[model samples]
Target: MSKVSNRTKIAAALVGVLALAGSNLVAADPLADVQKADGQIHADAAASQKKVDKFFDQAQDMLFEYGTVADERESLKAYNDYVATLVADQEASMKAIQDDINGVDKLRQGVVPLMFKMVEALEQFVALDLPFNTQVRKERVENLKNLLSTAEVTLAEKYRLILDAYSIEREYGNFVAVTTGQLNLDGKDVLVDFFNLGRVALYAQSLDQKTGWMYNPETKGWDTMDESHLRELTKGIRIARKQGALDLFALPIPAAETAK
Candidate 1:
């Protein structure tokens, strides 16, 4: 073989080796691609961490605002409860007042007639009684009757007057009274000493102790009393007036209900 041909073959072999090495360098690497993908994932994680930090700060501010509102909410709720209680009490009180007002109208109707009946009963009692202090008692009854008819008098006032009259009649039954007054006997007026004995009996005597009479309820008049009755009746009047010593004396007694 010629030296030139041999040199050409060696050169060709060296060129082929260089070309294979160049192709190997230009080929794709799997490890390098994996590294590039991991770097991209790390960048995404950094951005997400920044967003979480900002959200945590906002959450802390929201919690602080809620705490501040919690204390105010309790105070406002307590004040509202107090107001509700007051409103309930006011409604109940108003209802009670309305009920009282309604009852007053009914009471006035019943009490007014009752007061009139009481006054009439008092006048009848004065007429039936033993005719002592007649003018004063009759005047009281007349005053009560006039008050009942008057528009200026209230029912409560009329009722009080009736009760007072009844009390006076009741007191008259418990004791004796001796009075010097004008006595009408047989259509003639005479000054006499009157003996009132506990709503049971009434005896009248002249100043000289010579003339006397007993009251008769059925006939509504005065009748002449016996001589024996005069001694006991005169002594009773003197004793009642504190002009004589106290002593038990024989006297006629009758049960008469003055208050009734």
Candidate 2:
């Protein structure tokens, strides 16, 4: 094999190993492993590409039906069912694709830079406090659109990459909470950083009948701020800050703050 192809194969092999190992690669050169994984990730990306295209087709078909039909209860329910089914099927595959992407230690290191970009994109939506998270969803669509420009990856693979990044942020979001009240910055108490994970967690809890925030049209903001939202404003937790400031949870905090 050529040098480039050989490197790529080794990288794919690392991804398979990491997938079996999950996140337990302590004491290993994570960056090296990640680089190796990314090499293969791009290669196997072809397999995932087909699934993503099929999903998009199904989603688009449902959306077309939804748009054409009256927005009635039954019609809306049908549309939602279509989406729920699609999401259900894609969730597992997306998870695997993301794990491989993230497990490629190289990719994890780049997450912070993307997080900054994601944060900036997220800020615009959060600021609007749009109902049903219209802004976030819109941003997500746009982000996926932009990821298409990345060379050497299919559009579907790029989408997989972005989704994986969200998962990474969600899985690691609570690390901010762990530092609340325990860590101090500038002698002030830190509230939990409201990012994708916190938003997802709070949203899930609410969906499950637990307490949660509500969009207040009167205030044009999110209301019913719970401990979960404010528990670590000053935790001085570190995040993807090298990429600059990210508007996580609609809050315009700098990447420097995340680095702390």
The models' CA-based lDDT, in order, is 0.83, 0.52
Count residue pairs with overlapping backbones in model 1: 0
Candidate 1 Cα errors over 4 Å, as ranges = 1-87, 254-260
Candidate 1, residues 1-260, lDDT tens digits: the string is 99999999999999999999887776656667878989988998998898899899999999998998997899899999999999999999999999999999898888888887878878887887777777899999999988888899777777887898899889988988888988876678899998888777878899888778877776667778778877887888789999999999887543353222
Off by over 4 Å in 2: 1-143, 172-197, 200-219, 222-260
Best by TM-score: 1
lDDT of 1 at 102: 97
- How many clashing pairs in candidate 2? 14
The ten-residue window of minimal lDDT in model 2 covers: 176-185
Clash number for each model: 0, 14
Model 2 superposed RMSD (Cα): 50.9
TM-scores of all candidate predictions against the true structure: 0.64, 0.20
